[model samples]
Target: MKTDDLISMLAAGNPAPPRAPSARRFALALFCGLLGALLLMACLFGVRKDLAEVAATPLFWAKVALPAALVLGALWASGRLARPGVAVGARWAAIGVPVALVWGASLVLLAALPAGDRLAQVLGTTWRTCPLNIALLSVPAFIAVLWAIRGLAPTRLRLAGAAGGLLAGALATLVYCLHCPEMAVPFWGVWYVLGMALPTFAGWLLGPRWLRW
Candidate 1:
């Protein structure tokens, strides 16, 4: 057969059925996971005693907003990964911008403080427990996001897992803020990010096994 005629014949065959998209499933699972995390946080660690009054301040809002931003970015990337043949593109960098801005502001905040107090600022009262708490809280969301991914087709397993981990971590942090009294950005920059990193690393390590098609 002529090359052109052979190609045409091959192209004329019936196409395979398309799979349903997983974005909606991912969203619903994520919502349920977050709801469970919130309930857990509420029961285990009640909202900060001063939350009602503090809720009115910018500092309290900033704490909530930072992790919320991460949740949005991570979930967006995770949902993208749920589909095969999709490229993450430059959008990943945009996710880090908010964190960078917060880090920059944190540096400024540190610079303004006296040298003696700088260390204390970064190591807030919960220095030992903060990251652990954040990591522990992320478990529910991580499992939920993973369940979401398992039902879809993802070519980039590691990246998808990391994004799932991030979504879980961010949501967990959002809940953590309600009970955490620390307002220092440097503390968040270090411990909060580390807390998130734990799951991200776990996902990266376990992705190949769990996310395999």
Candidate 2:
């Protein structure tokens, strides 16, 4: 067929109405998943007793802010990944910036504390179960995020998966802060981040299988 005739034929047919962009759909799905996770947190582990008074404190807000920042960065990276052939570019760097700042602050806090008490500060009382709890809390969000990206095109599957996991884990950590009593930056730098990393690791391992188009 002639090129002009083929072009004319292609333009003649009506295309289906355009639906919402993948990123918007993903955001909505993630929001629902987060709500479910929050409900799970409330049912399984209620908020801390002194939360009302402590909510205004720097320590309490610090816990929320770090994870909140990570959530924003991950969401941005994930949104880009949802679109085929789109480079995430500087978005990954944005994710690392919050993490680096939080860790740097943690080191400074540790330095300022008495040398003898540094270990206790890092280990905290809940060291053993803290990361596990965060990982468990992330399950709902992770599943929801994975579902959101299932049909979307992500050329970098592993990176996309990691971003999804990070998003889930960060959201879970935010919910976890309601029940967590630890107020130390060192604890958050080590354990809370480790909790988030577990899901990121899982996503790296599972992304190829689940995200394959």
lDDT per prediction? 0.82, 0.82
RMSD of each: 6.0, 5.6
Instruction: Please provide, for model 1 over 62-87, each residue's C-alpha lDDT reduced to its tens digit, 9 standing for 90 to 100.
Output: 88888889988888888777666566
lDDT string for model 2 (1-213, tens) is 133543454476522111365656677767876897788889988889999999989878988998899998988887777555567897688789978988899899889989999999999999999999899889989998877765565557888888888989999998899999899888999999999999999988888887776
- Where does model 1 exceed 4 Å of error? 1-20
Please give the lDDT score at residue 36 for candidate 1: 80
Find the 10 residues in a row with the least total lDDT in model 1: 14-23
Model 2 ranges off by over 4 Å: 1-19
Clashing residue pairs in candidate 2 (N, C-alpha, C atoms within 3 angstroms): none
